[model samples]
Target: MTSRTLLRLAMAGAVVAGSLTALSVPAQAGNAPKTVPVRLLALNDFHGNLEPPTGSSGRMVDENGNTVNAGGAVYVAAHMKALRDANTIEVAQGDLIGASPLISAAFHDEPSVDFLGKIGVQVSAVGNHEFDEGYAELRRIMFGGCHPVDGCSPAGPWKGAKYDYVGANVLFKNPGEKTDVTQSLSANPQVKTLLSDWGVPALPPVSIKWMNGVPIGFIGLVTQTTPNIVTAEGIKDLKFVDEVKAANVASKILKLFGVRAQVVLVHEGDQVTPNQSPDACSAIPGAGNRIATQVDPEIDMVLSGHSHQAYLCRVKDPAGQDRLYSQGGSFGRVITQVDMQVDTKTRDIVRSSVVADNHVVTRDVDPDSDTVTFMDFWRDKISAVANKPVGRISADITNVGTATGESPLGDLIADGQLAATKTGGNAQIALMNPGGVRAPLTYLTSPASEGDGVVTYGEAFTVQPFNNLMQAVTLTGAQLKTLLEQQFPGGPNNQPFAKILQPSANLSYTYSRSAAWGSKISNIKIDGVPVTDTQSIRVAANNFLVGGGDAFAAFKEGTDVWSGPLDIDAFVAYLGQNNPIAPPATTRITAVD
Candidate 1:
């Protein structure tokens, strides 16, 4: 059987112990029976970026307007260890792996797991990106191994993880279904042990944490949107339960087991602010800010990720009561810390009377030795490509838009995806998510008086981060109509984003501002011809979109489905076919006020 430390998965709770006295701060308004002071450190999204990504505009502007360099797992690791040394509990919301750089993703996110372990990531919830390579790979990394596909060493023996991962909502479709290999090899295959031996035995959900001298508990959950967002083939026999429902159920279970002072770590979250979002105790609701309101009352504080936003805002529950909420920005930019003071006498929490903030993980400290070694080992391998210049620029290709809606960078990518699909049948329409573009294009500068006047392969990768595949599918005018309707959430209660893309050329649609709220887009068409609302038209979008990434319920609304290859390959192919390829010679799409 695995030792207790190896089996340790998660924790959530309230406890009174002088152990935290050195790090204890003012109590937050919560209603702890007897407020016992505790310190909690949280981080999310880290996506396994060992080296600082070259062109990321991650340098956030602080209140003083000083933009500082941020990120790199080494700094993150060092920062996390500092918090723990202060007697604080370190927590990670989700997305500890997958969709990372070649060095990490190539190894099935092993480097990330190893780095996180060295830094002491006590517990983490599973996120959607966790399924990037499919369940088989996820199992390999989680249960421990070189992760067969990554070409790691030790040939075939199972290697256990240095940390515990939680999954409250991931369930087997049928009991007695075969588990992913690693799950089977989790404990002793030779001498059998109870199923619960590996944390969440029957159900892949469990809470294991210690607060003060009492065992605190935490419930882990992935979003209900998992099936649509992930590779459908991998999760065929598993079900992703509603996040809210799963959280509620798990909270009660922990309470039943005599564990109180619980917090939830989910791979889902809401609206975020920059590292500099006002130091207000409460957050206003918008796109991703509503997770706090959606959380179960049983949950005290929620550490959420997946939306790639950052904030230390609070939201009132269904009853107008406030709960602490926070999400660290993606790419290891920041580590959020919440200092809660619990009443030593009663186990109850103190309401909004504490300090919760996000701190920058500066590169000041030397990188973690082990993490540095792993990165150094992989750097040489990936540098051959990741660092090489793909193509050169003549003048400049930039998206200097400072507006909030969409950037010129966003438009450029949408055009690129469209260009790739249009080359053949020349797709009539193409859509790309705004979130897909990570950085603006920087033109190369002169050697003496360097200027950001050129774009390179490195710069291009910075713009389109996720390496998803491109998919070309036919969508009927009705599906097209649904695509436009997807711009806003429907019903009295719906999402803030309807998942509509700021599409490329060959497609033109306009909306009346005065039209009833969500039903905005009207004159949508293709080829200057009025697109029949029911007539079918060819559409090209990335595989992530075909599979539904940002709550696009309509893309899947198609009748015939064709899942082919990588979306990035389409881009590479487009550049290859149109060698000496140049950015679009004309502006593709325009949005009117």
Candidate 2:
């Protein structure tokens, strides 16, 4: 951390005493506890997958290949308890609910919230997905007495999470006003009034602890981009305030309360590289964007998430001063630990910097019996429908990426789109986003290897969980070329909203690695013919893309659009009609110059 970023949070000589002298408590512990040590276990985005899934790291590999299990709620509970024997705090970033298995989302966020509460998560921010059903649903899940959503009857284990869910920037139509509401921490009047108008109850911002004689405050924030990324239906009329501005507002408020040593627990992050580089943003891990660096310097430690990446970085703030910043990778794969030293007398942070290290939640240690029990209980309920085979892959649909090409799995999905859209051959090319392929075809049970196994309707829905219907549209050959080039020159980064839409197997193209944004793609072909950059091709894709979702504005330019309903259901129907269809002998998506 740089010198200027300290908020000039200078130590009170009488309060803090000596800096490093008091910080090295471990050395003089024999003299009876002089300085106290506190641990903060922060995590985020556990989307209600109670049980560990297959083919996942489930653990983090350190600098070496050694593997370690990262997390499980029960273990998280145990670890937090063990650490708190000193002065530890347990916290989460956000997205603890929504997009969860049907088991949890069915209950809105109640199950996840209650689950967090049980696991000892003391505080959290509101993730984008938390608003999947809007503020009313959030109220029902967080504060309302009963779980209004389904399967809540059993209430199995989530009982509800034990944590403070904070959303400093989540506001109503009213400005600078507190809505009539109830949450863990205290809130301003504007927040209270807004919640009342929306019929949604919200918790307060910045939970604080007065340890020794010093007060430490924690401010929670969700990404300002929530409204743009979430479904249009979920966030209607709601405003996602600017993250930096909201944080600054809160810091000033905390200042009024005479609180210092502030930490911002936000759900925003930046791209990261290990060991600090041009991309580094302070001592926090799991690198991402410059949000940590760009925010005000009053924040001592910024714990961030939402990118599901792994990085540990430290960056200098606007004043060329440094602050401690870190983020853990998504999934319960890795647990990040940041250690801070506080002065004993004043409870003021004397010599504060941080160490961002990670540990894998490995199965090697005993899985907390309660967590295992709770997880297994829900696993059975969710897997009953989730694990059921949906449809048969008549071919070896695989996404195993080789050099410079697409996978067989990518082709099969593309083919599914084309087949769904080709009522009368209206479309020739099918496109999909690589991120949408949730699971791969099981080697033996898939459609390709027939052993009296048939594709079930359930299996197909699993592949297309987004429920995007297959649609066909016509574009001029020239306009189509522009669309393909757009993916290249821009890639996913050139345009902040860009999403890589993987083409179906029926298409082939060669894109250069060196090409600039909006121009990388060069040669393209479909069905044994070279495609002109400006030439159009009839295209098939899920409703999400065809409607300009993920910022694919080109699809909107198509002259004709036709819907074939949900693609997954179409896959199931196709399997029933074509029981023995074979996988294409050649992989469809390829590269060329």
Candidate 3:
């Protein structure tokens, strides 16, 4: 028998023996209590905010409707310590890294991983951002090694993560399947053989922790829509299965191992109503609810991320059992504390006894000294590159969208991309994915202290942290129109919701909110002239969009692709050329009722 099979058999036998012992020694007069209390301290979508986030990202609304500053690695540490006990198990749903601020992103997010390890994160589900740099880079992060390109940082050689990253839904593509592999492992025969092993998951599917002699199992799953959102080149060799199916399968395996208390750490969540109490459910309709309700009844609870909303809810499982479902807000702004009692005899959680709450990582608490020192070390190392003034902004260019789904910051970024590619690719227009605009660029002086209106490299880096390369492609006006149409739901690509693309200053279009999907976009213009369907035009966008990310498959039909500088480099250069830039008009895209 295989080693895995042997291990399963051994565990089954042990469970059987334990059951017999329990039956024989029942009804003792002074035996210990039958149940043990366990605490789970959970957070998700941290995104490496070592320092307190600035502007709206750093603050959360309280139950009293007051905005309060929250979230710093130090404060998060403090809160975790204050709330945890001997029976506590700290865990995360996903997005522990990627799209981070300069302090952590500068070193390929090693500092963030180190912080999570130091704070005792035992296991985490892999987020879509974990694959931002591709699966190979993620593997390097998990297994420990210096970045092949950047080498070791001043802190010393990396020791990898102390925690386990589990992803039951991530699987390797079969041989002979089409892929967009940037670095293929196909040439290595041994590696290929290993990948072909039967029923092998890309990452560990489940992690089991024994507490008070009862095993609690955690099954990890990323969103099945991961491929549509992340860069195709990075995850080209992986296939994401349905979240519900993967969770059920993993739960069955955990059951075979005699694990009865199971929790799903899924990297998908729903948006709760704005200004709702952090601890209130009030969840809007989304995939998180579906997964919570549809997963195997054996799964006891589900913690989620990716949507970056804070909520503590009790969703009904397939068997009509109310199970705790919660998500912590992104950027360490919130923590979900779950308390439950597990029955020692059955190794199962008491569903009715579970209690969960979302706590804001408020700044009022004394920060953890160790975390402060850790943040300082990384800050000092990146100060030279991060603190330099890149440009100036006359006012705040926030990513908060208007009614038409356009934002001032998105306009600025699209304009910058267009300028960068105008001469080289002869580009007439540019478009940017709204999701890529991570943060707002405020005119006020930041913690970097570059002075009011002065934007530092670090501030700019926080706004566009992905470092995607810019590319200009040739497309027919007809194709461009189709691209805009794809932004809404129910096209050939079947977008789940509207994701309006930010347009360059020279391009403008109008769409009807009540019109059919293919017929929504109208009045397409470039340079005050209506675009002819047959006319060829050069468009600029990040490589991620050109690779058909965000369901904009029409971009893949472009020709004459001309690569340019990194998106950050282009934005920085544009800011320098246009000093004291004001927020652009948000009238580029018009919507009609």
Candidate 4:
């Protein structure tokens, strides 16, 4: 059959099995003649953090709810090698690169990708952050070559990522054009390259990876909300489809190739109960759960990411049978081990025997020498610039956010942006999204100790690594209120949780959780003066936010925008001006409930 005919048949199969009713299986027929034990190791959201993360970002709650330091590619490599067996397959949920630290971002995350290859990640899901630099950059990341703009790094030309990136739900969309190509993604250069690398696009979707004579089909899907969170220009020609629909279709297609054991590496997950153990699910009811419950039963295991919460769950599929749904916490902090038993005769998984566990990448173990050597090579390459002293701090200003999402580090970043735009744009207020504050400004962290009060350029870059330019925009008091309301959950955009923005010293507001959606915020004041509806104010924020990133749609309505310095540059300059910076009080955003 032609490729088009095969595509038509696969799509038809997806429609017929979309709402499959029966997932119940008969009791082990005749004692199950032959069985194979397969071990799967998984991680997610590495974000190019080669070294150990600092403060709360590096810490993870243990099974007993006690926090402990747990991350670093060296330790991750040690753990993966220790757990590897003849039947083991290593994989990641996604966000392995984009939004990285200075060490990796300096060379465009090539070190992290190379480390992943050495550590043996066979495949990974394509995350929303993967599209941050647009499709062309992603191609470079996957297919090795010199960066199109920056030329080659000190390590010479890029060698590309070793693992395959699969996205069943990501498709090509041409503007103002109509064709049978809605589900056709072959037009995309990256997709075309992936197809050329692995033919038979439909049977097992993007690709089918095998382990020890047993085929394990992988179907990767990113959240449909990707477009809202990513830059509009980066993905204007791409479409992110429903996770459940895509996984169901992919599962049906995989079964056609007699690959009964299927695993979905999805870049979407649920938020767990705060301060709880990493293994506890605790009645979670978020997007991950919503997708988990709706996917087809043929999928044996689901590995997820994006929410960055570590969880090992057994949510019921459409057939009402429990299937493994797991996520490893971000930044290589947590690794999930899933063991499955498959029957040789039926070539299907024995769902009842499936088990999973999430292990924290504890620092107690010795670091892997090879990984350490690799990291050291890159560390030495970027040392002179990374180790330069930027400023001093009175104490540790951490990114450990409050229940209301305010953090001392976030407040400090907002202050930096406000100071940056004050002279040029006459900005009166600044807002910093909690997600942008990647790490803390730790006073005496390990791996890079620059005395108790001293801060380095590398640390500042690690904290604000997106390198987004600062912009001052004009927003009416009414529009500002709308922006604040958008910070909470259940807005027009379906943000899974509340992302309370960090505001500068002049901007203060009180919000109540008990109030209704539109009326949750009150007591809006700019420098002690109550803001009025008609009053226009100049506010400072990164280019990402002013352009409606993170579902802040009201920001897109701002008028007469004035651009300023790069976020990291402004932060460094602010640090230099305010030597011996102290942790700011978290009183700006008051919570009533």
lDDT of each: 0.60, 0.58, 0.86, 0.81
Best by TM-score, which number? 3
- Give TM-scores for every candidate, taking all chains together and pairing residue i with residue i: 0.77, 0.74, 0.92, 0.88
In lDDT terms, which candidate is top?
3
lDDT of 3: 0.86
Expressed as tens digits, the lDDT of each residue in 302-387 for candidate 4 is: 88999889888888988989998888889999999988887766668889989888999999999999998998899999998898
TM-score, prediction 1? 0.77
Tell me the lDDT of candidate 2. Answer: 0.58
| Number of colliding residue pairs in each model | 44, 79, 0, 0
Worst 10 residues of 4 by lDDT: 14-23
161-236 per-residue lDDT for model 2 (tens digits): 3455677677664444444323311243443344344432233555565444455667778877665445555456
Q: Report the candidate with higher TM-score, 1 versus 4.
A: 4
Report the C-alpha lDDT of model 3 over 457-575, residue by residue, as the tens digit: 99999999998999999999999999999999988897988999999999999999999989999999999899999999999999999999999999999999999999999999999
Give, for candidate 2, the lowest lDDT window spanning 10 residues: 1-10
Q: Write the per-residue lDDT of candidate 1 for residues 366-409, one digit (tens) a residue.
A: 77776676667766665555554444444444444332243455
